[model samples]
Target: MALMKKLTVLAGAASAVSYVRKNPEKVNEAVGKAARFVDEKTNGRYHSQIEGAVRKVSETTRPRTAE
Candidate 1:
């Protein structure tokens, strides 16, 4: 049962990665919304930390264009 659960998680993760690669903007937007919801729920307890992590992820995942 544990092995099956792990496999299911891995499959879901793989699918999510493929979707994110094809739609980074949408993923980022979703992340932003999730962070906001958590922040509001927690009354800004982890707001800065969440924002920083999201910013770093967005920068890293963004597609670079030739100048």
Candidate 2:
């Protein structure tokens, strides 16, 4: 049962990563909006941390270029 659950989670994660690679712009836009919303809710108290997270997520989802 535990193995099946882990496999399901991994499959979902793989699908998400594939989607992000194909639609990096959409992912980045959504992330940006979410970050903005969080910043507003926190009154900008965690602005730096939010920005850092946004950057990391963007980088991770960005498509790789062939050498």
Candidate 3:
């Protein structure tokens, strides 16, 4: 049962990664909106952290180009 649960979680994560890779523009837009929302909610207390997280996520999800 534990193995099954782990497999399920891994599969879901893989699917999410695939979707992000395929729709990087949309993912980045949503990430930006989410970061803005969080920043506003926190009154800019964590603006830098939010921006950094957004940058990291965007970089990770960006589609790779062929050489």
Candidate 4:
């Protein structure tokens, strides 16, 4: 059972990575929505941390341009 769960998680991670690579804009949009939800739920208590995490994710997932 544990092995099955791990495999499932790995598969999901792979799928997410592929999706991010293919459509970084959509990924950023989803992250923004999640950040807003957290901010509202916490009444802005963790605003800075959430914003920082979102910025990092956005930077890491952005599509790379060719020279």
Candidate 5:
């Protein structure tokens, strides 16, 4: 159970990163949705982990590219 939770956090973090890279403008909205889903699924036990992931993703989205 612990290992599974850890893996979920890692995977969620990775996905959040990728999502920001793929869609920077929607990063906050998307990460928020993902965080809610994860928190609900885990019964709120991993809210911090998911929020951390979302925050990292949100940060990534905040920076603009040279374009």
Candidate 6:
């Protein structure tokens, strides 16, 4: 059970890395969606932080396509 848990964590981490690397546009879209969700939940109180976070996520998740 413990080993399975460790494997699950590893798999999730690896998928996260690959998702960010391969689908930067998806990452950007997801970030935007998340920001919007938060803004709606907070009634726009955290717009600055949400936008900043989305921008940071987009900046960090640049695509790495090989030709």
Model 4 TM-score is 0.83
| Candidate 3 structure lDDT | 0.92
lDDT of 5 by residue, 1-67 (tens): 9999999999999997686678787767866887898899999999888888988877767877798
TM-score of candidate 3 on Cα atoms, chains taken together: 0.87
**Model 4 agreement with the true structure over 1-54: per-residue lDDT tens digits:** 999999999999999889889999888999999999999999999999999999
Candidate models: Cα lDDT each? 0.91, 0.94, 0.92, 0.95, 0.83, 0.87
Q: How close is every model to the real structure, measured as TM-score?
A: 0.76, 0.87, 0.87, 0.83, 0.56, 0.75
RMSD of each: 2.4, 1.4, 1.4, 1.7, 8.2, 3.1
Alpha carbon lDDT of residue 65, candidate 6?
Answer: 70
The true-versus-predicted C-alpha distance at residue 7 of model 4, in Å, is: 1.6
> Candidate 6: misplaced stretches above 4 Å?
63-67
Residue 1 lDDT in candidate 5: 100
Expressed as tens digits, the lDDT of each residue in 15-56 for candidate 2 is 998898888999999999999999999999999999999999
lDDT per residue (tens digit) for residues 6-66 in model 3: 9999999999988987888899999999999999999999999999999999889866799
List candidate 3 stretches off by more than 4 Å.
none
Stretches > 4 Å off in candidate 2 = none
lDDT of 1: 0.91
